[model samples]
Target: MTKNEWEQDLEQRELEKKAHNRGYRAGVKTEGEASKRVELLENVLLEFVGYDDKCLQTKPGLLKRKRADLVDQIIYQRQLMRELYNHLDDDVRLKLRTKVESHIWPVTHSED
Candidate 1:
């Protein structure tokens, strides 16, 4: 092939590759944003549960009901987090799992 034809072919291939990469990156970004939203929701739920638990602890009469509510909220949050993990790409989910494990595992295992 002529030098011009070779250059044109190379340019076309490069453009196609760039487009493919852009689409892939956009997908990754969308998944990342969704994962972040889920994490934010989980944090909010945890904070609300913590506050509710503290409030209930201050009021003896409502303690049992509040404890049940807190447990339900925690379970819901965990389910949401799991769903988010399933939706994310493998690498993103792995990173999130690592972060959550590092921050939450010790506290979960620690005795008060």
Candidate 2:
């Protein structure tokens, strides 16, 4: 490709990478909120059932279903973030240098 084309493509990729990072951050935030809600709900449910072990054997009901759904959402969000991270080039990942990425997949300096 010509220099101009290469530059334009790089710019576009940069924009996409930024957008992806923003979405990933939002997803993480949502996941945290959902986790908190799940914890609260679990505590409430346990208290409501008098902390009985038999409550765990009961059939899935409203509270249990809601908790399950939130857990599923959290898992799905994590999977999406993983997929997005995998799709990005190492150069783009380095350029973004998001805290989440830094913690999970630290990029080393490359001579390229």
Candidate 3:
């Protein structure tokens, strides 16, 4: 083979080898188990949120629930805004804006 052909073949083999290793690692991690799904989720969350084992142990339920609640609140606010834009009058919109800002601003701006 020419030098260019030989280099191309070598690069193709290296790419295939990397793909195979990734597939093998994924198979090992999964293993067709329900518990493995939960463990994988925890691992991902720990890495994403930078949380340590001690924090998870101390307030696991509270921490998870708070994260979920924040997500739900964001969804609800989006839906409410969409509805208000199409349906609500200025008076109703002003009242809702005032009420939501009063309840939300303090919690969101706290020192903690």
TM-score to true structure, per model: 0.38, 0.44, 0.31
State, as a TM-score between 0 and 1, how close model 2 is to the true structure: 0.44
lDDT for model 2, on a 0 to 1 scale?
0.69
lDDT of 3 at 90: 88
Model 2, 110: alpha-carbon shift in Å? 83
Two-way TM-score contest, 1 vs 2, winner: 2
Give stretches of model 2 more than 4 Å off: 52-112
Among the numbered candidates, top TM-score falls to 2
Q: Write the per-residue lDDT of candidate 3 for residues 1-112, one digit (tens) a residue.
A: 9999999999999999999999998887777544544554554455446686764434554466456554554465565558656698889888777777767886753543
Error of 2 at 70 (Å): 19
What lDDT tens digits, residue by residue, belong to model 2 across residues 1-112?
9999999999999999999999999999999978867765564556444667666424554355566665754565566667777899998876766655556665533312
What is the alpha-carbon lDDT for the whole of candidate 1?
Answer: 0.70
Deviation in angstroms for 69 in model 2? 20
Model 3 clashing residue pairs (backbone): none
lDDT of each residue in 1-112, candidate 1, tens digit only: 9999999999999999999999999999999867756754555566556666653333453354446455655677678767767899989888777777767887763543
